[model samples]
Target chain A: MVDQLKPGKSIKDTYVFDLKMSERGMRINRLAEWLNGAENREAFKSDMDAVMDRFELTGEEKKLILDNDWLNLVKAGGNIYNVVRIAAIFDVGLYPLGAQQLGMSYEEFLETRNEKGAT
Target chain B: MAMIVAGIGTSHVPSIGAVVDSGRQNTPEWKPLFDAYEPVRTWLSDERKVDAVIVIYNDHACDFSFSKYPTFAVGAASEYAIADEGFGVRPLPPVKGDLDLSAHICRHLVYEEEFDITICKEMAVEHGLLVPMDLCFPQQGEWPVKVIPVQVNVLQHPIPTALRCFKLGAALRRAVESYDRDVNVAVMGTGGMSHQLHGERFGHLNSDFDNWFLDKIESDPQAICGMTHFDLMEQAGAEAVELIMWLTMRGAMTPDAQRIHRNYYAPMTTGMGLITMQDAA
Candidate 1:
């Protein structure tokens, strides 16, 4: 079905945030969405286990968030937007998360951009 | 009667807002992208005389979370607050909205064109909408013109097709023309040229596809209208499929609208682009 959707070419390394992914990552996304509010963010930061239990996140989902394993999170169906939200809680940003996804050191990723140190 | 003065297409990458807020426009890393907007600011404030802008952007799981995400939403409020997308809220002032114009468009879209959009009484706009405002009209203290935000669902699947977005733009033109006010409205579509922010292809950037898209949007938007969402994702990175929003801006103008200005820059993960068009007199 995914191949049928692509008319001619295929993006090898990208994960499209479609319905199936959304369904699979519903619990993780919900936990991330709750971080939008200040109080919710504070509560999650204070008691990570209780918050994960409250959101009914699976053991694997909790591990993904705890490890800052962004690539695995995406492979486990977490959207990048939501994953970034989760990453922000630990002060990890998009570039660092993306570097981890590409299996490169953050420095190697920066060297690839036109503006290396801008971020 | 109201008139459509101009239509604009821009990329609303969140990092652009950070650069503007930090006062780093002239810096070596950011000069090209920021300098390109100088002419745009002048044209908007002087040449176009746009009294209100219908900003076509998408919500990035900020205001409208996935729990109750609407496919299409229209802001009918008099003012919209800036949302805090994971980070703290931006230091920008609240956006002023033309409630009368918004209500009229809402009514026209539903009854006249049969596009049922969710009407938002209180909506908080994220960088998707505010970044465009900052690029075109840097808020000295107050915004130069009012805005009506039309948010689309580009994140989740079953998003509106390219052709449907084009038809919605046509409907918006009719809605704006039918209004009895003496307003000069500019339709602004903001998002994407080519970049994906997920998986192994986290920083995908396709300048070739983006430049071709810039040309096609001006000369033959119909060519774009026929492309499937998957086709766009494959060629222009997955997240770049948000280019569908640009069709709404193009559809708001005459088929032979004159292209006035065009710019493209791929500084980072996203292919940031800018284009302006005016309806032929």
Candidate 2:
């Protein structure tokens, strides 16, 4: 059967969390979604490998989380909101994660913003 | 018959909610942002006397997961719990819902309007809905107005087109007016002026586009309704496409609606913009 719904046109650095991306990142997204609960966050914090294993994340996916690679995680189909959940567990707030993605130090990125004190 | 008294469009940035929760609203950096909302809050609860609000917001993977996401979901529950968006639930009272009105709108959309929306008997709202409520309404022990949550899928691609969202709002106005109850209702279109929160384009902000949008949303919404998601992402940033939800509020109002209040503030990542509209008599 022909697929009726067409994929969104590719933008430079943006990854639209469409059906294909969602399917590819399902394991990681689900794992991150579970972090909504405090108990699950603690379990993941205690034994990272076990939690990742339980979620059936692939080796590459596990490596992405292990390396704390925010940019590549999105490339690996990790939804930004879901990736945020994982980042929170590592004490990485959105601004710092964003700065890392932009290849700038947190302070450097703050300088780029209109109001540095906004954070 | 119920009347649509006004429409509110505001950015529902999660960090703003954090500022409120952490008692930093009075701090130097955040005070201006919170202070901007003071008059707008008074107008909502006092002048308009909005008894209930239909909040059109998108869930940020908090309540519904990727497993079974709905394109459009309407809350039919009597009350909704605050979602724990991977951090923790905000310390806010459960939002009360108008069950009878919700059911009426659900039925009208499905049968009368041919908009087959998922009816959620249970929904936990995230920052998308709560942040706007925090800014617009006064929170004592409980919310002053009942809420009817209308969740849209802006996260996943192939989401509804910008025009479809506006049409949904028009349909909603009909649904609300048809009800036998005599109540003053307001529709809140929450989320985004401009900011992308992922990948290398994460910190993108477009104040010019945000300002243009704030103007067009009131004066020439038809121009906005014709824009594609790609166009919005390119010009405003990826996540800023959530601005389509504002069309729902515009769609629910008169084309000649007067803009009562307007404010623009870009802090860190998001372009926080706010506007209130009331239909011309």
Candidate 3:
């Protein structure tokens, strides 16, 4: 993660990673919850597993959270703030000022390279 | 005899004051947030013996709108009106302003300071200021100390960069010290403790980053100071990194100062962070 944060790096370096990390979390959480609530739970599991597979997290990030290694969790490249950023990206709260500050739209900031499940 | 007294950095979460005064703290999830302010309350009342507060806060487009925003502005009035924040303005009393001192600050920043700040004679203050005031000076129906407002540009794009905010603080220190009249002042830098409102990242809270930032603010501001707008925008979320304003507050303090009180809570999407440091050193 430190390598991910480099020399002469701007706060944006950390932010884009966090923003992407958060979006992954929200999409995964919603899919999991939706799968659990399904009338046809078994079919939803297959659908959810596919959705989960599309999540941006690598195998390592899931392992870190599962192992509950809070320290290594950050090392794996996300922390409470990272998770919260995902929540904000998925969940909604205060009116965001960054998009306007960055001269971009909210949708523009959320645009992912993978348009498979994009809004 | 103008002297800098204290530097305050906290989240001016709108509706904080009304929530606290109405006993919102008694609610199970909200107590820790408000309880953290008890020390700040005691300090501002007894220790921070600040005669006039030189509020170094930014406007949230509540008073002056996007149609005509000034890079920097100074309030040169005896009292300020609570402008409508889309919702009606809060029922709080009008904030007191020391016209004479404000006039002096305005002149100094324009002439001696060489900073071209808009001298606002009929400016109205919005929640960007009033909420923080309600917390630090809670007992007052009307505020006790006079205020000299220095409004920065944080609402619109191309805001003063983080380094610029810090430099402005140092310049403000020079302005305060050069004032001919005798006055004790405190500079407050409000906003940012890692809460992102808006977009998909609206509820972001960076406690780790927040803690790291607090330490850097005291020991090595250069670490934070050297950061770029892109860095802050990306790492701390575009909105959450406005903590640069804290540099203005930091600029008012001695490089090696004493931190009095610090607290951080995430009750909602935004971080309810608070810190109080003084230059008694």
Interface RMSD of each: 1.7, 2.2, 17.3
**Model 1: TM-score, first chain:** 0.89
- Candidate 1 — which residues are off by over 4 angstroms? A1-10
| Clash list (residue pairs), candidate 2 | none
Per-residue lDDT over B158-276 for candidate 3, one digit per residue giving the tens place of the 0 to 100 score: 56667777888888888889888888888888877776543435445666788888888877887888886556656566566568888888877888888898887765446667888
Give the worst 10-residue stretch by lDDT in candidate 1 chain B: B62-71
Pick the DockQ winner.
2
State the interface C-alpha RMSD of candidate 2.
2.2
Docking class of 2: medium
- Segments in model 3 whose C-alpha atoms lie over 4 Å from true places: A1-119
The superposed Cα distance between candidate 3 and the true structure at residue B90, in angstroms, equals 0.8
CAPRI-style docking class of model 1 based on DockQ: medium
Q: List the residue pairs that clash in candidate 1.
A: none
What lDDT does each candidate get?
0.90, 0.91, 0.64
List ranges where model 2 is wrong by over 4 Å.
A1-9
- lDDT, residue B218, candidate 3: 78
Considering only chain B, report the TM-score of model 1: 0.99
Task: Name the weakest run of 10 consecutive residues (lDDT summed) in model 3 chain B.
Answer: B195-204
